[model samples]
Target: MAGARFITLFVILSSACKVNSQSSLLEQFVSADTTNRAARFAYLKKVSPTDTICLNDIKRAIRDSSGDSALFVFNVDGFSTMLRYENELAQICKSNQLKFKLDIGTDIGYVDQTTGCYQDYLDLILFEKYGKNFKPDLHKEANDLYLANHLLDTISSWDCDIRPRCLSANTHTSISIVVDLPIKAHRKEWVVDKKPMFAVYHPFMDLSVVIDKDGNTSGYQLVDFIPARRQNKKYKEQLLAIAIQEIKNKYYKWKPAEINGVLLNTTHVMRLEFEAAAISK
Candidate 1:
């Protein structure tokens, strides 16, 4: 779990500018993390401060454990995974029934191939179309008040080359595919009722969720996190604890992923955005 231990943050413990480091505020926060050091077990990996893509943290992990129902990776390559193009890509994954991964690059293996839409993923990044439209990777210019927003839009008119079956051995069995619609069509999503002031700490946090066959959350894990360039390690445990709780409270589930018409357990990786403004008002 040493990998997980070093991970905490996209929760703050660094620069005063990355978060509201007021002693009164941070000291007031405490959790089981300090007493038990539980974060060591749940932590994923610390990300490079220069990287803006939130999904970069867990992309590789998702690819590895995807077979045998280890995970169901969510598509997180756009402005808001639940909002615009990311949403669209996720739906596409659902419809295609290909489980490998979306456009984001994988940490373990190469994705640029005709097997699934990885070729398209490479095309999207090489094009870098979203940067012109959304102006992502602006965290350097951000502070405690307003943070940079990374908007990724990879869905273009090329039509995904992904098919139900790919020539690659791993593609069809890949668990990195995004989960489809809810079991019940009427289930609604929850809006952020209160935006956190400390959201400026990092761009996002990677979340790992396991859904049972019944379309319910069966497991949750912290895969990776994004942090500031010079983050403060003062209230690190407290921040980690708070962020975990925030996700547990905010997450919702509708449907579990199915392949070959079998309802099986699935794991999904979600890049939880901490940049408050990235969410619509």
Candidate 2:
């Protein structure tokens, strides 16, 4: 009798363990498909644009498919941006009780909206809040660098109005150009750790204008990268132009050979000599 009771208890515990293991397996990452229909539908209904039901239709596809379960729309807007605001979408994921890790590739959407806060914070911590007259030498270097790199061809500039507070379809419609962030440069490298240069911030190469069907720009995203080699080509040409202009303005009285070879006659050569002197110091 004792042995039989012990065997029964062992079976009961083993069955419970197996059930728990199965539950764990159920929660693993799933692809965008039917099994995760419920969660996907919830997110669409919550965030989809009101004017068009295309996003809703996409969600319905998952519902109709057999055993397809993915948490978020994998294609439209990359996953990283979604995850950054996951708190807003947490309800759908929690309701589904699905186990998943979001694999949204590098976020290049360039939709930063905290301009006021960012500017205020930077002013408070990084630099003294000075008006237009308070230009730093670093700003001059950055400006020169940009002009030297982007002077060739027609560099396009646009004043875009981005709506940060607006997320839903209704708000997307109401987007207005209140204020804009002043873009400082194209290719810039800020020192993160002093020893090895790490590129922390870089402006996007391609500009994607996200406007409504009405032609009013709601938001814009930057994509595609202009390669470094291409930028270098433009930079060399621009530098040459600036050098010629400066020489003509300041030292045109001297002959070409003297201007090219002598100090103070050519800004390009003078800058080179100055750099060499600094290095020798």
Choose the strongest candidate by lDDT: 1
CA deviation > 4 Å runs, candidate 2:
1-50, 53-65, 68-281
lDDT tens per residue, model 2, 166-223: 1222221211121122222233455656764543222223323332322223222323
Judge candidate 2 at residue 59 and give its lDDT.
43
Model 2, residue 181: what's the lDDT? 24
- lDDT for model 1, please: 0.31
lDDT of 2: 0.26
Alpha-carbon runs more than 4 Å astray in model 1: 1-201, 232-236, 275-281
Q: Mind giving the per-residue lDDT tens digits that candidate 1 earns over 1-281? A: 22221122112222212211332111211210121233221222333343333234345444554454222232222121121123433344344442324333222222221111222232223224333211121111111111111112112111111111212223222122111211111123344666433222333446666545554553556676544322323333444455556545444443434322334454555554333223222
Model 2, position 255, has a per-residue lDDT of 19
* Candidate with best TM-score: 1
